[model samples]
Target: MQLENKVAVVTGASSGMGHAIVELFAREGAKVVAVARRKERLEELVASLADAPGEVAAYPGDVSSREVNEGMIDFAQKTFGGFDVLVNNAGIMDDMSPVGDATDEKYEQVMAVNVYGPLAAMRAAVNAFKASGTKGSIVNVASVGGMRSCAGAVYCASKAALISLTKNTAYMYMADGIRTNCIAPGGI
Candidate 1:
C-alpha cells in the first residue's frame, strides 16, 4: 500500500516496460490511467489486473499529439481525483538507418513520439500539480542509446533530446515540488 490511492498515468501501456510499470503500480495500490495506441491490448491489460488492489482505466491514443498528452492528464484528474505521477514511457526506434540513410519522415516520427510527446505530457503534469498545490513525480524513459551512439542516428538524437528535456524540467520545477528524472535503460 505504498501508493495507496495515488493516481498515475503511464504511456505505451500496451506492452513492454510500460505494461510492466502499470501492473507494478496497480499492485502497489496506485490507480493508473493506461495510454496506448492499441485499444485491445489495453483492455487485455485491464482485464488481467482484476485482482489488483488498485484500479486501471484504458486510454487509447497516440502519444505523439499534444492534445492527447493534455487529455490524459485531464482524464486522470477527472477520473481519479488527481494526477500524482506520470511515466512517459512511449517511444519509437529508428530502423537502424544512418544519418545519410535516414529520411525526414523517420526522424520526425522518432522525435515526435520520443521527445515532443513526453515534453508535452510533462508540461501538463507540472501545470496540474502546480495548480493543485500537490507534489508529483515525472519519469521519462530514455535509453542508453541516448548517452552513447548505440542505435540509429535518429533514435539516438531523439533520446538525447528527451534526456535534455527531462534534466531541464527537473531544474525548472524542483522548487515547485515537481520532481522530474529520466531513466536511461539498456535494451530489454
Candidate 2:
C-alpha cells in the first residue's frame, strides 16, 4: 500500500482524472476526501469505493471559492487526523476563442477555477503542513495547452498561470519539505 495511512484531498473528484485518482488513492489504503460540486456523483464515488482498503468521504463544493478550498483541507485534517497530499484537479475550459474573441467573463471564470482555486488551496495546505510538520505534496493538474498553443487563448493563459504557480510553490516550499509540481496532461 503505497499510500497506506496517508490522508489526501482531491478536488474535481466526481469525474475523469480526479475520479480515478480518488479511487487509486483509496485502493492504496489512503484516506481520501473526494471533492466536487456534483453531490450525487461524489456520493456515488464514495459508495463505489466502500470496500477499498482505505476510506473515502465526499465533499460537495465548488473549488472556485476560497472557502471551499480551505474547507476541504480542514476537513481532511479533522476527519483523518492527518494531512499529506493535496491534488488540485478542478478546472474549466474556455471556448476556442482567440485573444480578440475572448471575453472578460470567460477569462475570469477560467482563472478562478484553474489558477486562483489552486493558489488558495496551496496556501492552506502549506500552513497545514507547517502546523503538522509533515513533508507534504501538492499536485496541480493542468492542461498540455499550458505549454503550447493548442488550446483557446483564455484556457492556455489560465493553464500557463497554473504551471507558473506550481513552479513558484515548489521552489518556495522546498525548505519545508513540501513538494509541489504541475502535471499538464492532454489527449486528442
lDDT, candidate 1, 24-66, per-residue tens: 9999999999999999999999999989999999999998999
TM-score of each: 0.99, 0.98
Candidate 2: pairs in clash: none
lDDT of 2 by residue, 120-165 (tens): 9999999999998999999999999999989899999988999999
lDDT values of the candidates?
Answer: 0.95, 0.95
- C-alpha-based local distance difference test score of model 1: 0.95
Instruction: Tell me the spans in candidate 2 whose CA falls farther than 4 Å from its real position.
Output: none
RMSD of each: 0.6, 0.8
Error of 1 at 70 (Å): 0.4
**Candidate 2 C-alpha error for residue 160, in Å:** 0.5
**Clashing residue pairs in candidate 1, if any?**
none
Alpha-carbon error at 165 in model 1, in Å? 0.4
The alpha-carbon deviation from the true structure for residue 151 of candidate 1, after best TM-score superposition, in angstroms, is 0.5
